[model samples]
Target: MNTFRQHSKTRSRAVLVAGGAGFLGSTLCERLIADGERVICLDNMQTGTTGNLAALAREPRFSLVEQDVCDPVPRSLEVDAVFNLACAASPPRYQADPVHTMMTCVMGTHHLLDHCAAHGARFVQASTSEVYGDPREHPQREDYWGHVNPIGPRACYDEGKRAAETLCFDYRRGKGGGGAVDVRVARIFNTYGPRMRPDDGRIVSNLICQALADQPLTIYGTGEQTRSFCYVDDMIEGLVRLMRVDPAPDGPVNLGNPGEFTILELAEMVLDLVETTSRVAHEPLPTDDPQRRRPDVSRAETHLGWRPTTPLSAGLPPTIDWFAGLVQHRRADRRAPVAEASALHGVA
Candidate 1:
């Protein structure tokens, strides 16, 4: 049976991290492991790659389970906290399998929250900024009901998350089974950093990978769309703080950097950082893409005392370096196979 050590309230214990092999989840898992906490890292590897968790494979305090959240929840695990971050957050990837995405969000969240309720553990629902839709508000606060299209291409992810949020609260209100579990919802904004798949289709990773490859950076629409980007480290910090804060609010709180930048500006910054000769290539905008998306993190700041400190300029260098290394390694691996073949044929 899965179990955890029980001690002081502030002491480290076993935390179940759904999607723990993912870019964001891997980072969160690493952070928790470093802090002396035992982690049950669960993922289906749909969008999450095993490479992200390579470093933690040997960590004694960490355990990985290759299971999807849509599947049955493992029982008898005495978990202290449950972080539901199992759904795909990328547009191209999630839209490719809309029904699965929705099911992952709704059913997956149901199973995780059920586990938390059964154990009387804290539940942290990783909601998204996509729930705000195209944004009728300037800086989206938690109170905004949002303007999402239920039938749009992006609706699977948006509505899935919205439904997941409802499930979190419903569980809190004792509407579902098991005992009442402490639930905290964080509406995460655009986050980027190392471990993000080079082809995940997010603007940051896309621009960085493209710049490194010296390819024309693709811009959808006029490139005037604005978004707030938070480095993954800062995002993890906010999530940890939210999970630990006492007297936590039942409503969702925004977790993102307030520093906003236009797509054109971001493209320019990436180009400048990489010093690439690549120019911008315009394309037709995807359906229901948000024009401007930024979070008002006042609630996070006030409630959890969390705020992102990394500026885009400061965060880009490390990310660029990481992607550059990946590009180099890929080239090396490709050459290695060819070299071995040539060696067998007595060619230099």
Candidate 2:
């Protein structure tokens, strides 16, 4: 067994975050740095933007390494914890390159687990609620074996995460001389907030952007499919708490708000919030789309003593405001080239 440093209860420890440039990842980085921990953020930037890390870039405690987690990470840096949040989470982004996505979830996790085991550091895997698939259970608990379509469009993300969870547990169990790796898996549900890419294609961003532009809100299927949305702040808190548990849970634990809302209801809420003239437009439902997703979160509440306090009403306003700025910036950037061309023509 690798001899490594044990976590000290008194000191702020060094941490590595694999996807620290992303929406969720960057927020986590900020939170850690705020708490006076030294943070090394690793990202490939396929979906993550540098814009998300603008604040962290100025912070001396935070450092960023632009690298893919599928590759072996640097071994020299000592850290007390590793957060594996490197996968491309948005459906459209992951579907665009399914093979890479699968590799990221599987191999990326494999490499990070090895790193954690080598250093005897705690490993936290950001597993997703998609592991529940088109859940047969109404409110999914930690024990449910999900009904996932392995050959379907969404399988890349859904199954990849499932495979990741298995790998995390296996690492925790160890191959020989007892379990050396300490691992915690958080099965995250739908989360939304600032720094989310405007075109990420998740329903929240999609609806908010379309409403801001006065375009029709696209409704896939009958719009009755349900999802629970957790505010980014609450989601980050859940993840932080999971990583800090004295004796981590052996299996994956759910982390998300239990408040459920249908797709149609979500659209209506966005329209009302933004006060836009956008109408509903129907579209074919994507294949393998989960009909329902709501986490039970009992394990989180019991073990971590964590529950999301931000309601949807309170969360939506800030999210909508962020998207509004994004839309305006996009519009201005779009017109910049045209304006320059027109100025040149007039000069000629």
Score every model by TM-score: 0.92, 0.92
Which residue runs of candidate 1 sit more than 4 Å off their true CA positions? 1-12, 331-348
What lDDT tens digits, residue by residue, belong to model 2 across residues 1-348?
332235566756789999988889989989998877878888888877666766655566777787899998878867778999998888999999999999999999998888887777888999999998899998999999999999998899999999998888888888513356888999999999988888788999999999998999999999999999999999999999998887788678999999999999999899889978899999999988889999998899889999999999899999999988877666322212433322211100
lDDT of 1 at 329: 76
- Decoy 2 TM-score against native: 0.92
Clash number for candidate 1: 0
lDDT against the true structure, each candidate: 0.86, 0.85
